[model samples]
Target: MKLGPIDWAIMATYFVFVLGIGFALRRYMKTTTDFFQSGRSIPAWVAGLAFISANLGAQEVMGMAASGAKYGIMTSHFYWIGAIPAMVFLAVFMMPFYYGSRARSVPEYLKLRFDEKTRGLNAITFALMTVLSSGISMYAMGLLLNLLLGWSFDVSIWLCALIVLLYITMGGLTSAIYNEVLQFFMIVFGFLPLVLLGLHDVGGWAGLKTGLEHVAVSNGFAAGAWSQSWAHMGSPTDNPMGVEWFGMAMGLGFVLSFGYWCTDFLTIQRAMASESMSAARRAPLIAAFPKMMFPFLVILPGMLAIVLHQRLGAGGFSLPTKADGTLNYDMTVPLMLSHYFPQGMLGVGITALIASFMAGMAGNVTAFNTVFTYDIYQAYIRKGAPDAHYLWVGRVATVAGISASVAAAYLATHFNNIMDMLQLVFAFVNAPLFATFLLGMFWKRTTGHAAFIGLISGTVGAAIHHGLTLPLGSVPGIKGGWLGLTHQYTSEMAQNFWTAIWAWSTCFVVTILVSLVTKARAEAELKGLVYSLTERLKSDAEAWWRRPAVLGVIVLALTLVLNIVFL
Candidate 1:
């Protein structure tokens, strides 16, 4: 597909606006705190929007649309069941210890509440994860650009990396945060029209459902299987996702969602940048409102793509297929843009995707730099450094992070399945983290030694489980069963859910058992860091709507309605 002059103009304007913001904020990045933490001066609304945009990356946009095509409305569970509750929990229950304790990063919080070794382990793993995630974002953006416009993948990756690095290195966290707020608007505007136009061509919601009904029947499912979320979740084989209620609810809703939304440093860093404890608490809650409604914006397009080719025939675009002829579901959204958008609107759509790429890549890079500079470098390599020196190191780390991501992007081109393998690594690394944080913050008796040991045990248990089990019709390799195929799963999603459950359970049980035998820290030292040790803060003075708990309740109620309506 070729772009018109109008399209190039819109794309050029976005690049200029982002760079302008970076240069605009250059003066404020003098101190290490300013560079790393946005000087802790961001208002709640700004922080809140940044929090949402930071996570609205390639995975959320492209990956979700892909899943929506494959799994139907059951994919909404990622938002309704998996994300909203955890984000609310973060704002209402967990933000106090994180914000009150003055810990700069999540791993730093582990150090404050647990011990150095626990913090060190978390910092290294998190740092590596960020690099890998950023790299994948690059690959996604590059691949999509290449497919859509025949752009050089190498040039696309480097040019985008250069832009992210320039803005982040110059304006620091403040620039990235503010730019993220802008990107959020671009993404929403870009995709909203696409959803509307796609729905129109499919003859609105009712007609779209009829088309999907045909698809569901063709795929050997019940008529409503592709249109409803919970109706087909009774058994693995009943739904397109091949995941049962127990595994979906416990594994995704409880473990993976909480593990990511609550504990991961990427989202938490945005909340941490808020100016006050109240603002910090409100940030994620503010993010929850949009998050609850995102399925309509992101997921529906994939659903539309499912039957568009059948509707429009020669005029429509179908998803690209892999070597084995399986549809490359990730291409669903980009191809939809090419199919439905006009010349000028097409530019806006492409720019929106680029915004998502930036948000994902920049979020990971900023978080990676902060963690490396404070938790890794300062604590281990160089201690008691002057403020100016660390600030310089932070700028240096930003460049290094971008370079590492670029390298990973090139590595991705050579190995098509590398991302699937990396997901396994992230599963083991991230699945056990919430248990460590949960016990460390809420249970004062939890020992540092136990937190460290439990993390290892959790990751090991996840690997062992994956090794012993294989999803049906898969070979014993990256997909698992290297040890022996003792059990089988109907789908990879089910396998992932079970892996998370086992990881979380192993970590939780091991942490408690070891903490029972090990020594606990003094209660005085735990103040402000442990939940019970600290005084409970309140939003009672604020209006009912502004209160975090109240907002959380409202968000959850709306999500419940959506699930039921779709079901």
Candidate 2:
């Protein structure tokens, strides 16, 4: 179906206006802080919105939709189970340490708490991961646009990257955050309507329940482990594990939620941008509420699509498809939208998807800018440089980051699809880092050397698990030739997840064991590493914890209720 002239006009208008906002904010970014972190003056509400927006990548929409079509309400666990808990933990338990210590970045925190070598290693690893992850996010958007609208994937990616980069480069983090606030609302306004329309098309809740019952899995509630085979290989016919539903949910909740929400620079930068420590602590927790419910906007529609497709006797509704009659599960949501949604709703749905991509890309570029400016250039290249020089570096880096990301998006076309690529990236890069941050923050005895060892081992181990099946290292390059490796692996999300689990577990154990044999940082130096919630800091700590703690408890209670009620 052709996008109507009105639809095109609206999209064009939105794009132009956002670009204008970015340029308008350029004059305000006089210093590195302004360029990278909004000079630390963002209000809590704007920060919260940007926080939520940053997390809403194109893969997230597709993944949520894919799961929704396949898993029913259970798919909401991605956020409800994982993100909310992590967000609450960060706000109530972690933020005080980060904000109080005055660390500019997570790796900086490591250096202050551990050693400079550790910080440098982490900074490099993290930069590489961000590039890969951001590239994937950019790729997903382009892929979606190409598949849905028949646009050239390269052109789509370049256009998207250019817009995001333009704004991010001009206004810096301030522009990104402000635009993110608008993008968040745009995403909700655009997607939720489609979901509502989808339900309407499905004949409401009763029709939804009836459709769900007809599919393979009626209730994802029964307790057994995800099957090791399905979990390992990642079959569309089964849940990632086929493991006990509850255990898989909880385990994933523990791993992914904490990993992405706490450690990911995209989300952390939002909290870091707040005007004060109290605001930083609260902004993330506030964002958590929306995250827990985000599935309603994203994944739920996919589930509804599944129920409708099944009832219509549509085969491969949630499966991948080829030229011949086949299923491409990743296409489920888009196909359903095209088939079911009316013209107006379809327009809105498409806009929401684009909004999701924009918000995520904006967040990614901003975070990339911050890390580039603070960690790399300021820390090493130009130590004690004035803010103006650093700000210039950040803008330059934003362009470079966007260019690299667009190229990555072009390369992603070689991959299977968005969802598979996303999970694959997350497993290797994020899984180990999640373990590292947890150990680093809570365990004072975890040495810098242990962190370095753990991160390298986990990353290399996970890569081996996945890369062994492929020739990722065998590109005609000096590195590839030196390694003497051939691409053997075909990427699969399930394989990646299993690899990630092993990677995380390995890192956790190694870090612990290594710490046992290593010397701890001096207690005085490690003071910022651990939470010191003593009476001396009681007043400050209590004021900080009150609202966020209550919010956290409420979310926990809600998750328990959701488990009982929905899953």
Candidate 3:
């Protein structure tokens, strides 16, 4: 894993451009809109790429790779089944209300569509979620850098934090979006070569499949289990993922996917930055293009790492272990980079990871600052502050958010799989959120009080469900069952899926029941917010192919083909 001077030079060169972009955009930061919302002037394509790149952080790169190592091709479910349809639904159905309502953040939308309490609840929780998610990006970078460079973990995380802070604080959302686009390119170029080389070493797709059979069989799964996506999903015991198709479809695919893609403000903020409603709608639909290709760049590396380690024996690397003596799957991607990459290319690979780390953390910080400035601080702390004063608060919030994330980074260290921890958070937060948004936007009769009550009930239900269920072999603690184990799941991921399902169902049911007893808002007040009340959106695109629906259909078809091919 030793690096040469050539590798150092490549990394050094990348930092210059990253900082230069921020410094270049600093002159435009005279107003809050310019700083926090990118002046709503970014083109659809730029916003689109940034949409995907904003998510290209620790969870996507390291976490997906980790899941790939543990679950094999079943990990692609995160993209094919879990992400694609949801992105399509967002662009085609949800973005109209989001863009049309002129809401500043997701919480602001809830306020416009529901009530103050629901908005307040979402804003505070979203602020915390962004900080924690940002911390994940920080923790992964810190840990990976420590492993690769033998640097102190504390110093590495802090240094990365300082770099992101300067750029994001300087140019704000505009800087974060532009840098995310750059990170997207760097990630593709840097990681595509690794995938190519790894595939070559393992005899391409056929050889990789052959190699995975032994690993799958040794782990108590059916032969060829690692090579197929849905084939082994009929029974939890048939595959490494250890969840039935029903849970996979209803939980990860329906609840978690729609919850994140539709409701989470991180990716939604990128689209909201676009110049026009047309562009905003097009953003996520277009982002799905690159999102579809990421399994190879990230997931395949993990799959290859595992097989290659076994094939190459002791000279090759093994995954790191947790304090409890189980494999720490989060190390899968970095270990693969160290094993397969040569000196010059190794720098590119490392820089790609750095780019992802920055895009992810910066996206979170920028979103956090905006939500704090508008949704929380403006609404609660100071109602009539001047834009100048609020702008000042945003900059201050950026500093505070990063500081909190640095603390939260330590919290992530307690988990064996970083993805497991992130999913648990999403299950508690986003899963129930989709229900609130669903009823609020579609059923004008849904009252604000009902929405607020439903949100609390959903979050509480998630906590209860999580506490009552234990992932097999995990003791009652962070992984759940502290309240007493009523049900046990085969894997942590399986537990996450079912927990999300329970949370979503609870929220959906409670919202409807409460709405029946509560009085609805005036129909006039629901105008631009509710689906039945609002007029349908017309595409501004001149060509048929440019329409969001057209693009969404094309991508979904391609994704379907991939799923079937892999199956």
Candidate 4:
């Protein structure tokens, strides 16, 4: 596992190039807008790439692969169903409110649509989640470096924190977005070869599937688990994912997907940074093209890992294991890299790993700084501050955000798996967010009080469901339910989907009930914010094919084809 001089050179070159980009973009930070939103001057393609890159962090790259290893092709549901539809919805339907309203952040839109309390709740929750997610990436980076390169965990964390802080502080969101694009390329370059090589070693896709089928047969599981997506989804006990089709669609596709893609400030901020309304509207759609194909790169590696492990045996190509002999699925990608990549390419693979960590960390810190500065500091602490003063606050907040992430990284060390911990957080924070946004945008009757209370109730409901239903000894950091309903869940994944379902249901019902009793805002005040009041701004100047609706239809159709093919 020792890296050669050429590998070191490649890694060093990547760091220099990224830092150089940051310094080169330093001239753009002339205003708070530029610092926070890239002066709204980014092109549609660049914004689109950054939109996906910002999310292509450790959690995604590694987690998706991990899920592929654990749950087979069913993991593609996270992409085809859970992401593409929501991303399309964001681009075609939601972007007008987000972009046309001229709101700087998602929470800002809430403030305009609902009230200050709703905005406050969203801003604070989003800020905390961003930092914690950054911390998780940081922690995963350190853990990978420790496992792969024998680097000290603490040293790895601090080194990554310092690197992210340096580039992001120098150029702000503009720098982060640019680096994310670069990271996206690096990830493709790094992992594409590994997948090709691994596929070759596993004797191509057909051989890999056959190998997994044999493994499943030997292990006393369904033979089609590795190849089929929906066949085993009829019951939780039939597959490793343990999620029924209804729960997968309603919980993951409708609730979690929309919540993250449409509402989460992390990805939305990238679209918001686009130079024009057309670019903003097109960003997610453009990102969706690449996203539809990402399972091939990310998830395939995990499937290959399983084939390699089964073929080579434990002594030949080792899989990461916990003390209890269970697979540490988060290490799937790293294990593949260690097994397949050679010297020069090894550096590329490791650099991609580092790039994912840095990009993810930068994404979170940049979003955190922007939200905290504008939504919290400007709105609450000191309104009408000089633009320069706010810019300074943003930079300071960037530092604070990264610092908090470092602390959170330390906290994450206690968790057994990075992907599980991330999913747990998503269940807690993101699952219920879409319901509030869905009501506020389309329904003018959704009062601020209702939005705020429903959000709180939904979040609390998610926690309660976890406590009541999650089984003991199921996964790390989760014990049996306080209500002694531990036997209710067929698997932890099932528990997660059900948790989201309950959370979303609670929010949806509660918001409706409260909004019924509360007075709706005046129509004049709802202009450009609510769906009914806003004009349908058309992109008529563009060709018919380029229209968001047209692109959305194409994407949806393609996604349907993918689902059927995999099913």
lDDT of 3 at 302: 85
How many clashes (backbone atoms < 3 Å, residues ≥3 apart in a chain or on different chains) does model 1 have? Answer: 0
Query: In candidate 2, residue 264 scores what lDDT?
Result: 73
What would the per-residue lDDT of candidate 2 be over residues 1-567, giving only the tens digit for each residue?
568877787787778778999989988988777777788898877888888888777677788777666455656656776577788888877887777776888777777766777788777767766776778787777767887899987787877887887888888888888888888877788777667877787678776666666654444522211111112223332443233343344346676667777877778888888998767878887787787778778876776766665655543334445677644468766776676656666676677678778778777777777787788878888898777777778888998888877766666767645535454554566678778888887777788888888877887777665554432223423211223343332223333344567678878998899889998777777665675421123334455344667767887788667655554
In candidate 1, which residue ranges exceed 4 Å CA deviation? 312-315, 416-419
Better of 2 and 3 by TM-score: 3
Give candidate 3's TM-score: 0.95
In candidate 4, stretches whose alpha carbon ends up further than 4 angstroms from where it belongs are 313-316, 414-426, 472-480
Ranking by lDDT: 1, 3, 4, 2
Residue 550 Cα positional deviation in candidate 3, in Å, after optimal superposition: 1.2
Task: Give the distance in Å from residue 371's predicted Cα in candidate 2 to where it truly belongs.
Answer: 1.0
Better model by TM-score: candidate 1 vs candidate 3: 1
What is candidate 3's local distance difference test score?
Answer: 0.88
**Clashes in model 1: which pairs?**
none
Predicted structure with the largest TM-score when compared to the true one? 1
- Clashes per prediction? 0, 31, 0, 1
lDDT for 190 (candidate 1): 94
RMSD values for the candidates in order, in angstroms, are 1.3, 5.6, 2.3, 2.2
Question: What are the models' TM-scores?
Answer: 0.98, 0.85, 0.95, 0.96
The residue-by-residue lDDT of candidate 1 on 1-567, one tens digit each, is: 789999999999999999999999998888988998999999999999999999999678988999888878888999999999999999988999899997999999999999999999999989988998899889988988887899999899999999999999999999889989999999899999999988888889998899899889989999999999999989999988889999999999999999999999998999999999989999998898888889999999999888775555643667777999887788888888888888999999999999889888999999999999999999999999899999999999999999999988888889868877886787798999988888888899999999999999999999999999988889999989999988899998899999999999999999999999999999999999988899988678998887888888888898888888998
Worst 10 residues of 3 by lDDT: 415-424
* Residue runs of model 2 more than 4 Å from their true location after superposition: 217-241, 245-250, 313-320, 323-326, 340-344, 414-426, 460-498, 533-546
lDDT agreement with native, every candidate: 0.91, 0.70, 0.88, 0.87
